[model samples]
Target: MRMHKVNTAVTLGAVALLTAAMGTASAAPPAGRTPHPQPAHPVIVDCVWHPQVRPADFMIACGDGNSSLSSLRWSHWDQGSATASGVNVVNDCKPYCAAGRFHSYPVTVRLDHPQPWKKNPRVQHYTQMSLVYTDGRPDGFDRVVTYSLWN
Candidate 1:
């Protein structure tokens, strides 16, 4: 009876350990990295109409730090055309600002392709943009920002 009780206790302990390990794994960050903070102050910085260009030009100002422009996607709301590209924030310019200081990151997107914006008679032009970022922490506060015009 003593041996059986000891074995039972050991089995229970093993099961608990396994459960905890699985929980931690499930709680892991998405894409194997922590997600940046969602944009708190989202605003359209510039919208330029260029007839010389087929589609148009769009520029957006997003958060300074503790954020990132993970994805830059656009669509022609009036014409139903869309295109996406992976922008190199670091290559373009320093995307982040001084820590704890409010900064604005400007992103300019020029549409070169002749898509719905050029084809649709009703739609003279259309433009849209999006930006995403990962939140920052006290320990990991020194973040390198990326921008287009800066670089």
Candidate 2:
């Protein structure tokens, strides 16, 4: 009985220690890795009609809150259509002011061919931008943020 009690104590102590470590890790960035700054209203550059073949990574600000899409790389693109994947990094502002941690979730974005905006026949814009998440969605974010994109 005494031997069983000693084993139980050791196991409980180890579990507690591990749980504490995990909490700390989540509360802050992991050691040796600096946190990347998230910008307010990140620009989706050249969002006009037939944009200048931007296969490079770009940021998209949803404008609803602090979370934004970061680091999009197009894996495929042809004839004004493109498919890419990126990350949605969010500021989890918990506890109080300035005590926030950023978390990244995998997401996929699609840009459809441009069409003339209803308001202006001369100006054109991508009719839609589809954002589908692969993992770790922030609270209140839909699995897909497919919305109309206009100039």
lDDT winner? 2
Assess the local accuracy of residue 132 in candidate 1 as a C-alpha lDDT between 0 and 100.
28
Candidate 1 regions exceeding 4 Å error are: 28-151
| Candidate 2, residue 51: lDDT | 38
- Number of residue pairs clashing in candidate 1, backbone atoms closer than 3 angstroms, sequence gap of 3 or more or interchain: 12
Q: Provide the clashing-pair count of each candidate structure.
A: 12, 0
Question: What is the C-alpha lDDT profile of model 1 across 1-151, one tens digit per residue?
Answer: 9999999999999999999999998785877565533222222222233232222333333333233333455442223323433332332233434324433343323322222343323223333333222333223223433233200
Candidate 2 residue pairs in backbone clash: none
Candidate 2 structure quality by residue, lDDT tens digits, 1-151: 9999999999999999999999988787778765754222112234333333444544354443456666778786654666778887777777542687778889888888666545444444456678888986877879988866645
| TM-score, one value per model | 0.22, 0.50
lDDT of model 2 at residue 132? 88
lDDT of 1: 0.37
